[model samples]
Target chain A: MVVAEFVSELRARFGIEFKDLSILDEAFTHSSYANEHRELGISDNERLEFLGDAVLELTVSDYLYRKFPNLPEGELTRMRAAIVQTKSFSSFSREAHFDKYIKLGNGEEAAGARQRNTLLEDLFEAFCGALYLDQGRAAVIKFCQQVIFPHIDAGEFRGISDFKTALQENLQQDGNADIHYEEVSITGPGNARQFNIDVYVDDKLLGSGSGKSKKRAEQAAAKAALVGLGVIS
Target chain B: MVVAEFVSELRARFGIEFKDLSILDEAFTHSSYANEHRELGISDNERLEFLGDAVLELTVSDYLYRKFPNLPEGELTRMRAAIVQTKSFSSFSREAHFDKYIKLGNGEEAAGARQRNTLLEDLFEAFCGALYLDQGRAAVIKFCQQVIFPHIDAGEFRGISDFKTALQENLQQDGNADIHYEEVSITGPGNARQFNIDVYVDDKLLGSGSGKSKKRAEQAAAKAALVGLGVIS
Candidate 1:
């Protein structure tokens, strides 16, 4: 349940031993702990958490993109989001038994903050940041792919279907529908141009949407139409 | 044009020729072209585009995340968006002179569609997808590092400063002004709590923010207060 035990478990899980356990210690130390023990001279996990969040997102995103070459952009983005979100990160932390190893102040421990999602997510990010700094991006990438990507890939069967494709396919299948996408208006000038698109199915307005581009607007309109028709959840 | 000529041109710009030019041609072919020329028995670039988009995002996100070890999530997310956006994809397509090689239908060509953002973006995505499938993930990562990562890295020096640090340093130096963050509300169920936090200086509310956790909310509040006080642009 101590920080040392946590590092041993993490090392076993990640297959990388810490050269400086101080990095791991700092990563597990919350600001509350620092606040309570001012003389510790240890920087809290906030900065490391901040760095690790980026590192995690990047590593996971790269891995998924490479492995799943057939997935669309929106699907990839959502998958990356699902993996990096607090909920996912917390699960990873919990699986790592993060609560057992976190170094919290007496006040925080008294407050019963061991299972806090915020704490878990921050700790996971901090851990990732520490791993990256100590081992390198390659190690971080391998750790993430091993620890996180499987959960995301497993969820691919459920809760993560391609909404864009679903919408497009549904529209196309409806009596071989002739979907007319018109750029109704383009507001603003230069990079600010907001394209408004109206999707018509044989002159009946299926949906309307606005985006930076007419194609995106059409895609949005298609997405809205799918929601309107209960084609996508 | 012959596939050899096309590969050489791409090699000049992309610096990597395909072991097979079929992938590149497959990437360049649009659905409209396939529909028009049924004899070619070739599928369009949509599937490849979908795949490529994922590869592009993952590659760019991975590069950005590792390249800048200390950037906050928001800034990193924004940078990812900027790099993988339609505009960026279009630029990439232009750089490769994709306009000259893309196989579009007569109707699309008449509509000046070769220069279209959607078409260019799709072509770029397809190109990536084809490259990934043909050469593998390692090749894609190498291509991304050579083609996309450098551009993203160039923008890194512009907008990735730590807002929280800037805010704290500014407030602390101003006659020892104590900065405080308090959680105003904690809503939702066990795992999905929404936290609202307010940043205060001497009992005066500087900024408030809401996030999935208190730490995030505090960071958001700090970010807002920094911008509000003109501590960061």
Candidate 2:
């Protein structure tokens, strides 16, 4: 694609015009592209990706802090991780149609590198980095607030099996209730040990489950309790 | 110490007074302290620490990006890691006299938790978090630019061996030099293996070293080359 068209697309999509087009150019340029165009003095997106990773983290963190005043640190961390994971970021890039603009070497393009999760994730981050450099933090935050924060608010990215934390947060809403996990049984040989655990909320049994380890069993019990509490489908 | 005295110390040290002293209070309150003071509705610094961690990373990443324009992503990552590491951050906390301000439970205080590196590191992050909340990103950036950036600039936290990357950067300054590492020999049993490697800069034998693995041996050779090139003492 032509550079002007790419720039136009970004402007239309992100609602921000780049003061320096070179930063945007660098953001889309893969290392392979830079290597192939060494005489052109083209730089890769890796450095920008590094910078964008930090920017994305900070923006998401600040949003989470303000939005969830009562949420604990662990839950905040988990939620942030879920939002920024490669899968989530790649999905965002796909929605942004990043593959159409990324500049890859002939070989990488032939290898179908554009659709790769790692490349898409890196491109998304580098784009954010470029946006931050060109337009500043306010622009980047606004972009995230529009593109990323809504998904988080909708609870769309809370991947499988975080029910334990979900249940804890639900229970903690009322007050600090005495939540306990008791190992009810241990069986099987040493090499293949199994544990059955029961979860109690305020001295009342909520759920029970079995697993290979105490932690896993507790998580299973929590999942069961969350289901019983109708917190998840 | 009383909350007013804590607020005064923060103002004297940081040159800015918080609009809401409660955020500052939460920043210094350890989980143990919060646990003991549940009735007072005291909050721990962990959440702030989480926010601060992201703020610190973004500020540092931006600083490094601007300061070292020619640095590759890998080296920038390494430098950022060094600057924000637990040891480096804990040292910053110590220099800031964070121990004097942190509120811990009586039991934790008796157990000498004030001197712990982990606690100090957490307090430093929490302080940044509180500053970001009270002032904004600009203030947090200013705080880090004053406190953390200088240490990074001085190369105080480069820590142990990163000679391979250092050597590579030093050689790549005058354009890309052909740097090669070749395994010269492998000896000893499989479980107790030793390998000798030689590092060549532009086809010149600069240094040679031996270690248990190829990676280690290459690093050792790079370190010797750096020493021979008068780059590090």
Task: State which candidate has the highest TM-score.
Answer: 2
lDDT of 2 by residue, A20-123 (tens): 88888899999768755645857789989999999999999999888766556776898899888899999888888887889998778888998999999999
What's the count of clashing pairs in each model shown? 0, 0
Candidate 1 local Cα displacement, residue B183, angstroms:
26
Error of 2 at B11 (Å): 2.7
Candidate 1 per-residue lDDT over residues B92-203, each given as its tens digit = 7888778788998887888889899988988988888888778876787877776676676565433535455556667888578877888787777634557788999888
User: What's model 2's lDDT at B14?
Assistant: 66
What are the per-residue Cα lDDT tens digits for candidate 1 across A13-124?
7677877788888888887775555445556776567568766766766676666554545566666676777887888899877778888877778888888998899999
The residue ranges of model 2 lying beyond 4 angstroms of the native Cα positions read: A159-229, B158-229
Instruction: Please write out the lDDT profile of model 2 over residues B31-146, one tens digit for every residue.
Output: 76765564575668899999999999999999989876755677679888878878978988988778888898877888899989999999999989989988998998877767
Docking level of model 1: incorrect
Candidate 1 wrongly placed segments (more than 4 Å): A19-84, A103-113, A129-146, A149-233, B31-74, B125-233
